[model samples]
Target: MRILLTNDDGFYARGLQTLWQVLAEDETFDVSTVAPENQKSATGHSITLNEPIFVTEQQKKGHKGFAVRGNPADCVKLALQGELIPRPDLVISGINNGPNLGTDVFYSGTVSAAMEGVLLGIPSIAVSLAGYNGDDYEDAARFVHHFLKQNNFIEGGLLNINIPPLPANEWKGVKFTKLGKAVYNNVFEHRLDPRGRSYFWQAGSLAPETDPETDLYALQQEYVSITPMHSDLTDYRKLKI
Candidate 1:
């Protein structure tokens, strides 16, 4: 199958590199990669229509990919136009450097890349390792390969998978969980620059949620979290007359 690979963590990110290495080793899969030239984490679904976007050729031994001077969504968008690669049967974004759980999806460039693929009528997935300090990508990459091998992906939606940053043997298995509630208590600490100019630094901490069915809670329990996502943002309950 033709698979388009991209990530918000840029072309050189270890997470993306690990995924590319794993997928490219499979002889049955045809993989093409297009990713940001620099990290574009939390960029959401922003597209670059106003400015000219550029793609640079990059190679990892035998595999060749393109690095786009834009966000994760832009990589998918430009790649789909048939400039860099053929239209893919599947699009897989990330193995993100950090987790994309709960409301974090709203601001995630990883999820947004997959969302853009779904918008173009392709089956997609956003995979993330749940910790920033993770050193192993084996479990996560293998999990993605197994998921695609075992399941049939229908068009029109994407899956968000967040793996606990643990070895395969230590994991508590997988859970299809809902988006969790993780609201941050944000604080803008005002400060003066060297020039005596006013500035602010934003900081926050996650507020806990008790729901066990949520992705956040699943992660806390050491389980891999899988949450299905779609483009529709409608609040259907409110539409009831």
Candidate 2:
């Protein structure tokens, strides 16, 4: 199988590199990487249509990689259009340095990157390791390999897997969970720069969670959270008659 790998944390991120190293070692599949040149976290599903998007070859230890001058979704978009890798059997985004749980999916470039693959009618997954300074990618990568080995993917959807940063033996095992609520108390903070210009940045803490079966609560419990997220964001249950 040919796997098209992409990530939101720029091309040089360690988490993506760890995933690259892990996936490339599997001789059962061929791997190629295409990712944003700069950080595109929380960039949603933005695609670069008007801009002249191009792909240039990058060589590392005789391995081929592509540095996309666009968002994570743009990289996948360009790849499907014959810019980077050819038609792929699967598209895997991330091994993101942080958790993408609950309402975080609404603004996640990692999930958006995977959703781009869904748009191309290919199976996709967005894998993320909890925390920013995690040194562990084994369980997450293992879970991915096992998941693909065990089941078939949904046709027009993607899976969002958030692995807690814990040793394999310490993991509470994987759970197919639902998205949790994200209550943000302080959405922004005002600050002044050296030049005395006022700017506001997104800075908020997750409020206390209410459900353990949800992704956010599961992560806090040291459980690997797997949510089969669809491209559709519709509230079908709320439709009026």
TM-score of each model, in listed order: 0.96, 0.92
Query: Largest TM-score belongs to which candidate?
Result: 1
Per-residue C-alpha lDDT of model 2 across residues 116-191, encoded as one tens digit per residue: 8998898999999988775677667777777777877646478899988888788887899999987877877799
Q: Which stretches of candidate 1 lie over 4 Å from their true place?
A: none
Give stretches of model 2 more than 4 Å off: 154-156
Which lDDT value does model 1 have at 69?
A: 96
- In order, how many clashes per candidate? 0, 0
| Residues 165-210 of candidate 1: C-alpha lDDT, one tens digit per residue | 9898999989999999778899999999999999999999888768
Candidate 1 has an lDDT of 0.91
In model 1, the number of clashes is 0
Error of 2 at 168 (Å): 1.2
Candidate 2 clash pair list? none
**Would you give me the overall lDDT of model 2?**
0.84
